[model samples]
Target: MVAVGYTLMCEQAGPKQLVDYAVRAEDAGFGLAVVSDHYYPWLESQGHSPYAWSLLGAVAQATSRIDLMTMVTCPTRRYHPAVVAQKAATMGLLSDGRFTLGLGSGENLNEHVVGAWPHVQERHEMLEEALQIIRPLLDGETLTYSGDHFEVPEAYLWDRPERPVPIALAASGPSSVDLAGEYADALINTEPDPHVIDLFDSAGGAGKPRYGQVAICYGPDEEQCRKIAHEQFRWFGLGWKVNADLPGPESFDSASSFVREEDVADSIPCGPDLEAHVAAFKRFVDAGFTHVAVVQVGDETQPRFLDWARDEFLPRLRQL
Candidate 1:
């Protein structure tokens, strides 16, 4: 059976609310919770972005059983790979071995805050170099390294989980899929694309876990749900190519201004209809995702959504 997970949505909620929701999600019986690591919300209207690592520490202390992940963090810019490795190790110890570090090449929206963002190919190269430093340290190694894009004069992780934290790599293309297969313990993606899964397996991730995410807006009223999804998440409708290159929330706001409610409603499973939500998730399962995270779009709708998930959606989704 595919494991169902919840999105922590750091971009939409403050640290306290994230911790509270994580506790509720565990109570709601979600087996996993993926939190985004962003310096800025995709749009200003989304209204928040607390440091993800700090929020995760609180999440670790607050929840007992649910697995926690970064969703995806970029170690190439703004953070050194050594720091990310240290953070991941500390998180693993704090969460009692339930933390998974998810890494990606990153987007300009966040990375650009420090300096000019590198091109897509160079970004991937930087990520590969970072993994070289991160993977060994998580395995409890002390190292001094020099690479094309990064340098670690000397670094070591003194505190680490008995078992190395599992690493999941986010991939949406051939290059990234190859990287995930060669280095990651698991795979992560936003789409239900079987072709990517096949590529990942053939490239060296055959037995690794595959995680997928699907956005949904669940509410008593369909129209309200549609409105909420479009208003907060229309930036997604612009697609990753555009989404990754944009410099800020204002850029996203302008780029996605053309997105209509119907467009978001068409793609995301909207409203309280059980079957619609089920079918949306089934696509990822059908495409062979081992874990499918339900990204609930609106922050205000979380309490109601969590209640409904515990009472209804999860049980039905498990059957698929």
Candidate 2:
């Protein structure tokens, strides 16, 4: 059967506060936690970006039996795969081996900070290279790698967990999905596009786990939430240049062509009645996403969602 999880903002909620919520979610029967990994706050208004790996450690200590995953982490840039491998190994050991490393091609918005910019095509190659480099190192031995994108000399992981950690790549495109099926343990495609399932299976991911996530605002009113979700969260749907990594001079053109300032405004579903919130999730379920994540995006009514998730959402979802 398919499963359910949530995407959390560590910077917004703080590690302990977020972990405390996940503990309650686990108790209430949620299956996993997909924490965001960001170096800088995506929006100036949101105002936070705690180091994700440290937060994952707290999450591991807080919940037993519930999977703790980065909704996705970008290893090709800001951090080297070798270091990510080391940290993931430690997190796995700390969590008693319940961790799954989520990978992605990454956004220019985040990865470019490290000075290596990636075009979509290059990012595809980077993801492949990153996985190749990181997986072997996670084997708990001294490793050596020299690739087109990265190099490591006799770099070995110390304190790795006894078992090999699973790797899941978050991807939506055909080539990237195929790469995951060919190399990774699972898939996380956050957009509620069920057609992505066919794309994945076409690439040999038929039996592998697939995950999706969506944003929602829950309250008595629907229009109010849409306004909040759209304006505050609009940064997400902006075009390739602004999001995908592109080389110098070209990225500005790509970002400018496909995305406009209004599109960057928040427009995700928020502050709606329990019925509408369930309806929003149903789209993912109908689209064939086996694991769906509901991310709480704003600060104004985030707490009321605890009551909404427990009293309103979970109980109602069980019947469906």
Candidate 3:
């Protein structure tokens, strides 16, 4: 069976609401849950960005059965890898081995705020070095490294879990995929592309789990859902190259000024139609993704969407 997880969009909800929804998700039958780790929301209209680690601690305490993970966190900048390692270890212990650390080479919006904006290749190299620093530290070894991007002087996680927390690396292109294959316990991608799966498999990741995320908006009214999706998630269609380089919400606003509601309606499944939502998920399953994270856009429809998923969507999805 494909593992279906719910996305706790920190950008769109506050800490209490996120914990409430995660507890609801466990009660509603989602086997796993993932939260976005962002310092800022993609757009100002979406409006909230709580410290994800704190909220995750609350979710871990509130829910017992569901697995939890960050959809993606960048350890190269803003945070040193050693800090991430210590945090991930503590989260793993808090969640009783149910936590997975999802990582990626970050976007300019988050990483650039630290005052150093590296190019894509440099970012990838930084991520590789971060992984090297993280893996050994999580394994409870004292590590010292002087790499091109970062340096650690006799660093080790004192409060680490007995086992290393699994790492899932996000990949948007060939280089990232290659890195995932070489260093990660799993692979994550936003798109349903078989070529990516093939590339990962051929590059030493054949048996590793692949996770994919799909954005959708479900409401009683199709038009309203389309509007909400367009308003909040239209930045997703900008392509990774553009999405990774853009500095802030205003830059995204300027870039996506021409994006239409119909364009969002075309890409994301909107409305209460069960088949449309199922088809969106099936694309990822068909592309060989073992785990799928469904991001339901908009805060107002969250309760309804979770109810619908538990009662309608999940049963059909399991059958698929």
Candidate 4:
């Protein structure tokens, strides 16, 4: 059976509320909790962006049984891979070996703050080098290196869990799929694309964990859910290349201004219909995802959704 999880969207709520939600998710019986590492919200109306690592420390202390991870963090720019390795190692210790580090090539929205965003190919190269540095360090080896994209001067993590934190890579295409298979311990993708999984499996990820995320807005009425999803998640309908290039919430808002409610609702499983939500998750599971994270788009219906998930959603998904 696929391990179901909840998303603690740092871009949607403040740290305190997220910590509270993390506890609630654990209480509601979610086995895993994934948090996004973002410096800005996709849309200004989405509102918050707290430092994900600091909030993660609090979440680790607040919950005991739930597995914790960054849905994805970009180590190529704002954070050096060495620093990310340290943070992941520390998080693994804090979570008592329950933390997985999810990484990616990253979007310009967050990375541009440190420097000019590199082109896609350079970004991939940087990520590849980052993985080389991070993977060994997490395994308790001191690393000192000179690479085209990064330089590490003999860094090591003193505080680490007994087991190495699993490194999960976010991949959406052939290149990234191969990178994940070559270097990462697991796979994460937002879409239910089986081709991505097939590539990863053949490229060395055969027995690894595969994670998928489903975006939805659950509410009392379908109309409300559609409105909420459009307001908060319309930017997601923008293709990855477009999503990765935008510099900030304003840029996203402008680019997504033309996105219709129907467009957003078409892709995301909105409303209170349990079957719609189940089918959305089923797509990923059928595509071979071993872990699925449900991203509840808006905050207004969190309590209701959590209640529904505990009583209705989870039991049905487990039956699959």
* Top-lDDT structure, candidate number: 1
Q: In model 4, which residue pairs have backbone atoms overlapping below 3 Å?
A: none
lDDT of 2 at 200: 83
- lDDT, candidate 1, equals 0.94
> Residue by residue across 1-36, what tens digits does model 4's lDDT show?
999999999888999999999999999889999999
Q: Which of candidates 3 and 4 reaches a greater lDDT?
A: 4
Poorest lDDT segment (10 consecutive residues) of candidate 2:
246-255
Candidate 1, residues 64-161: lDDT per residue as tens digits? 89999999899999899999999999999999999999999889988998999999889989999999999999998888999989999999999999
Q: Write the per-residue lDDT of candidate 3 for residues 226-320, one digit (tens) a residue.
A: 99998898898999889888899888888888999999899999998989999999999999999999999998789999998889989999998
**CA lDDT of every candidate:** 0.94, 0.74, 0.92, 0.93
| Local lDDT at 215 for model 4 | 89
Model 3 alpha-carbon drift over 4 Å, by segment:
none
Please estimate how well model 4 matches the true structure, expressed as its whole-model Cα lDDT: 0.93
* Regions of candidate 2 where Cα sits further than 4 Å from its true position: 139-142, 239-241, 245-267
Taking all chains together, the TM-score of candidate 4 against the true structure is: 0.99
Q: How many backbone clashes does candidate 1 have?
A: 0
TM-score of every model? 0.99, 0.87, 0.98, 0.99
